[model samples]
Target: MINVKVMAVLDLVSILQKREIAFSVEDGTTIRGLLEIMCSQYGPELEKKIYVDKDKELLNLNLYLNGRHIHFLGGLDAVLRNEDTVLLIPYASGG
Candidate 1:
């Protein structure tokens, strides 16, 4: 089993109902797989906030793995390791 912690900021705090969560995933699970697990646990309210096009793609949420953006690590395919910390921060735009 792979153990990880998730830190959520902004509106996600309310959506998830907590600022931090302890999560577990199977070994070799990827970031996308983690989100899928969360979706199953949290249901559509959480799913709608993160996925678009019926879960085909990620929405505006920004995912960081151990302080580095997942976009640079390997997108959603980035393999998770034990004790990894995944930070979720929604994209914000202001003019």
Candidate 2:
């Protein structure tokens, strides 16, 4: 198993129930796999908040791995490692 540290912004604290959490994934799990596990653990409400589709074709929030944006790191196929830090930042819209 690989242990990852997940950090969420204040806007997502209510949904996640905590600002930071330690999550365990199977060895060699990719970002997409990790997201699937999280969605299953957190339920439909959280899933809807994160993904625009079940296939993960679109994302409603920004995901960072160790302070680097996932978009530049091979999207969801990025492999995770033990002790890696993941951050979730909710979308913000302003006038």
Candidate 3:
């Protein structure tokens, strides 16, 4: 099994802040699978609040696995290994 650490940002993490969140999966789980699991764990109510589009892509978040931006490599298909910390960083723009 593959073990992954997921860290959320903004309101996503706010809901799960009560406990340490991480999970074990099959050896080849992609970022897409990780996100679906997050939505399930948080449920529809919280999921509605955290994202605008919960389907193929994330709206408010910039994903990083082990400090490397997933988008730069292969987006949701990015391969992950055990002990990788997945960070969900929310987008912010200010002038």
Candidate 4:
């Protein structure tokens, strides 16, 4: 199994309870799969914040893997490794 650290920002703290969590996923699990597991644990409220559709497409939230944006790596398909860190930063809009 691979150990990953997940950091949630902004409103996500309400769902996650804590600012960060350590997750253990099966080896070779992609970012998307890890997120699915998290959603299941956190329930529907978190599911709606992260996924845009039933297909589990990521919403507009900015996701970073080890301080690097996931979009640069490969979006949700980005493979994770032991001790990798994932940070979720939600978009803020308003004056």
Candidate 5:
């Protein structure tokens, strides 16, 4: 099992109905696979909040695996291990 912690992103919290969740995934599951599962479990609205396009080519949120950014680890292809913690952080912009 892996744990996912969703930061205080209102839209996402509303969709997921919780700030943190734990679920089982097949061993060797990648981050992309995990996101896909979340989309299916929560709904397309969750996908829209995370993905930048219908093609799912870009991520609008920042993903961290056990405190390290996914980009540095291996982007969406980063493989998850049992008991790993993935944190989802929303992007913020103001000027």
Candidate 6:
């Protein structure tokens, strides 16, 4: 199974904490698959919190594959391998 680290933006931590969304996905699923699942559970509105537009155009959110940014690689369509580390980090920050 793959491993995912879901990090919320500082401003969006409340939503994630409220929903009890943790920092891991232990199943071998594609990036798109995981995002879809998150949308269904957290609603499409939540997708915009992490993703860019409603059309899923990626914003400044950083998706790293074992420490490599997806944007510098395959973007969101990137494939996942067993034991791969998927880290999703929102660019927003707050004190």
Which candidate ranks first by lDDT, i.e. highest? 4
Per-residue lDDT of candidate 6, residues 3-63 (tens digit): 5555554555665554224434546566777677777777755687767776677654776
Across residues 1-95, which tens digit of lDDT does each residue of candidate 4 receive?
Answer: 98999999999998899999999999999999998899889999888888777777757588999999999999999999999999998888788
Model 4 Cα RMSD, 1 decimal: 1.5
For 1-95, candidate 1 gives per-residue lDDT tens digits of: 98999999989999899999999789999999999899899888888878765954756688999999999999999999999999988887788
Backbone Cα, N, C clashes tallied per candidate: 0, 0, 0, 0, 0, 0
Report residue 35 deviation for candidate 6 (angstroms).
1.2
List, residue by residue over 1-95, the lDDT tens digit for candidate 2: 98998898856788889999899889899888887887888888788888888876799899999999999989888999999998988897677
- Model 3: which ten-residue window has the lowest total lDDT? 50-59
What is the TM-score of each predicted model, taking all chains together? 0.91, 0.90, 0.79, 0.92, 0.86, 0.64
Question: What is the lDDT of every predicted structure here?
Answer: 0.89, 0.88, 0.75, 0.91, 0.82, 0.64
* Consecutive 10-residue window with the lowest summed lDDT within model 2: 7-16
Q: How many residue pairs in model 5 have overlapping backbones?
A: 0
The per-prediction CA RMSD against the true structure, in angstroms, equals: 1.5, 1.7, 2.4, 1.5, 2.2, 3.8
Scored by lDDT, model 2 comes in at 0.88
TM-score of 1: 0.91
**TM-score of model 2 vs. true structure:** 0.90
**Residue pairs whose backbone atoms clash in candidate 1:** none
Candidate whose TM-score is highest: 4
Q: After superposition, how far is residue 7 of candidate 2 from its true place, in Å?
A: 0.8
Residues forming the 10-long window of minimal summed lDDT in candidate 6: 17-26
Q: Which ten residues in a row have the lowest lDDT in candidate 1?
A: 51-60
**Residue 71 local lDDT, model 4:** 92
Prediction 6 global C-alpha lDDT:
0.64
